[model samples]
Target: MKKKVSLGFKLPAGMKPPEAFELVSSEGADDPAAYLAHLEDSQVEGIVTGMGRRFDVSLISKLPARIKIIATASVGFDHIDVKAAAARGIAVTNTPDVLTDATADMTMLLILNVSRRMREYLELMKEGWGKSLGFEGMLGFDPAGKYLGIVGMGRIGQAVAARARAFGINIAYHNRHRLPPEKEGDAHYFSSLEEMLPHCKILSLNAPATAETKELLNKRTIALLPKGAIVVNVARGDLINEEDLIEALANGHLGGAGLDVFKNEPHFNRRLAEFPNVFLTPHAASATVETRTGIAKRAFENVARVLSGEAPRDLVQAP
Candidate 1:
């Protein structure tokens, strides 16, 4: 007999449901009440969700005993409470590695867009460009020869370094642990973030959202960066303090910023849009067709493995 599964979100285009499982669509799973109701009426042995839903301690505590796993189709698991799920003897897993290149590509896109002021240029084109500009009218920096400081030199960070190197940018990074020489390449490593900031003409955040990383770039830390430095983030939004970043941008401490994620997401701060130097996307760093499909496949594989009494390769922790 096929194991029952609850699908919290629609699959990506051209994707097929996994075999050996009876899938139930749990529409509007973003709503806790609706999701709980769906669970109450179904014997869902596993659940597959995206970051849109939160599986916090409160919700995990109330999950039906039949839930064997919670698999998220995104690399980051900040939305789910892993410890809470583990305590309940439920396996928690996230799709990583597959989205690394896509996310890193998005980071490079942000860096190029912000440094070249593409946001303002695009706006100008939309408004019907009639006026000619002086040579320095809308000057933007070139990435070449500039130092790029990357926080969290993980898979995505290393990928960003490879891409940035192709653009002739110097790479510097800080991480919990230094990468081996082969993976480290020519990128400079910094043991301290504060020491690394002064050299970074461009800064990219690629770290995860954890307690220690929350608001990592607040007023005090933002002051450490060189004047006129550009900021690009393809990581979690909470890694930056929007209020502090806005203040710096308003006061001209920062040259510009490019972001693909926000603290509140879809409901990001309206103040950011007002700035000509700020480029924003609605948290779509890993939205590529190939990446999304790979992520979803990994999530489904994790669910399928656990349901078949085999350990999942990407299990967050043993439950």
Candidate 2:
């Protein structure tokens, strides 16, 4: 008989489970608490989830012992407490690489939106573009010939560099270790992010959120950038201190910002919406049809593999 599995949320179209498994739906309630309540007293061997839920130690301890794997449909596993999952002998898997290009593309979109003041221009158009508009009225800075500093040199960071190069932007990055000359190309590397910040006219945060990275871009770090610098974050929302970012943006210390993620998501700071210099998007960096479908497929494949006495291809280690 095939193993029983429950989906915390509905799968994308055409990404059905294999015949070897009996699939049950939790409808759209993918949150940890709701999903657990839905599966109460059930004997399912696997559960599929996404980044929306918080699978902390408390929740992990309460999960049914019959559950063997928790497959998340996103690249980031920070939402899942991997250590707690490992201690319970429950495997956790994430969908990486599939969303790399999609996220990188969104990063570029943020850069352009903030630098060119697209949000303000769009609002102006809605208000009739004004009859007496002058060329200098809505002038914005061009990214060409500017230095772009990347905080993380991972696959997505490298992909952002490739896209930025086409716009005549010079790339400099700070990572734990320097990349080989072949992989780095002409991009410069800095061992210390603080040392690299002053030279960056446009800064992008692409690092993962960790103990060391949480609130990494606080007031002290923001002071390192040149006055009137632009900041963009496509990574975790916890990376930046929103209070500090808002203060900087208000005082004109930061010329503008583009953010796609937030610490208190779904209910992010309302003050940010009032700032014309800020461009915000609900955490949809990897929202393309193709990428989302790929992630959903990979997540289910992980669940199917683990239930069939096979190791998942994208198993995440405890942090």
Candidate 3:
């Protein structure tokens, strides 16, 4: 008899269903709880995709002992506690590499959108003010002469820096370790966040989600920024204190923000949306069809590897 694994995913209906496994999906669920109860009752290995905090180990109570692997369609594993999964002797895996460039592209897109007031112009056109190309309209800032501080100098952050150079941005970054000169020589590294924050006219965050980075941009750090500084976050939502960010933008202490992720996803930060100076995206940084499909396929392949007892190349736990 073939092993039956339960898959939990919230994928596009357009996404092709996996033919290789027996699946349990969100498409048919009245709620995720009903699906989890079903999985808990069954005695078999589990396969999951698009699993975002739906089946955290504690939530499972007496989790299936037969379940050996859990894989998620998302690249970030903050939603699933790897430490908890590892303690259970369950292998947890995440998708990476495929979404880096696409995510970086959205980061740059947000930066351009907020800095240049691109959204305002589109709104202007919709309001029938587009006919005249006059100098009376919004005066946007050019990034070419600006200072850009990137919070994380990882793969995705490096990609954003490369493009900023074409706009003549002098990039400075803060990270745990300095990127080697060969990897990111154009960016001058700062070991401390304080040293980097004051110099930035634009700050883009690309750090992975982790305990150390949660609310990394709280009120104290936000105070360190120069007046009229623009902020961009496409990495993780929890890194910013949405309340503090809204206050900073509202009081005019900060210039504007371009956010692709939020503290509460699929839920609105009502204050931020009302600001003309802010640009918000629906966490679609890696939402391109090509990127999403690639993430799914890679995640599925990793699930196969983890279940087979081979070391998953991108395993998040060893923690």
> Best candidate, lDDT-wise?
1
Clash pairs detected, candidate 2: none
lDDT of 1 by residue, 98-156 (tens): 99999999999999999999999999999998999677799898999999999999999
Q: Which residue runs of candidate 3 sit more than 4 Å off their true CA positions?
A: 10-19, 28-33, 40-44, 130-136
Q: Residue 138 in candidate 2 has what lDDT?
A: 76
Q: 180-244, model 3: which lDDT tens digit per residue?
A: 88987768889999988999999999998777899999899999999999999998888999889
Against the true structure, whose TM-score is highest?
1
TM-score of 1: 0.97
TM-score of each: 0.97, 0.95, 0.91
Clashes of each: 0, 0, 1
lDDT of 2 by residue, 1-319 (tens): 6777877666666665667688777776556677787767456888787677788999999998888999988878898999999999999999989999999999999999999999998999899875766767878899989999999889999999999999999999999889999989999999988999999989999999989889989899999999989999999999999999999999889999999999987779989989998999999999887888888788878988898889999999996
- The local lDDT score (0 to 100) that residue 68 gets in candidate 1 is 94
Off by over 4 Å in 1: none
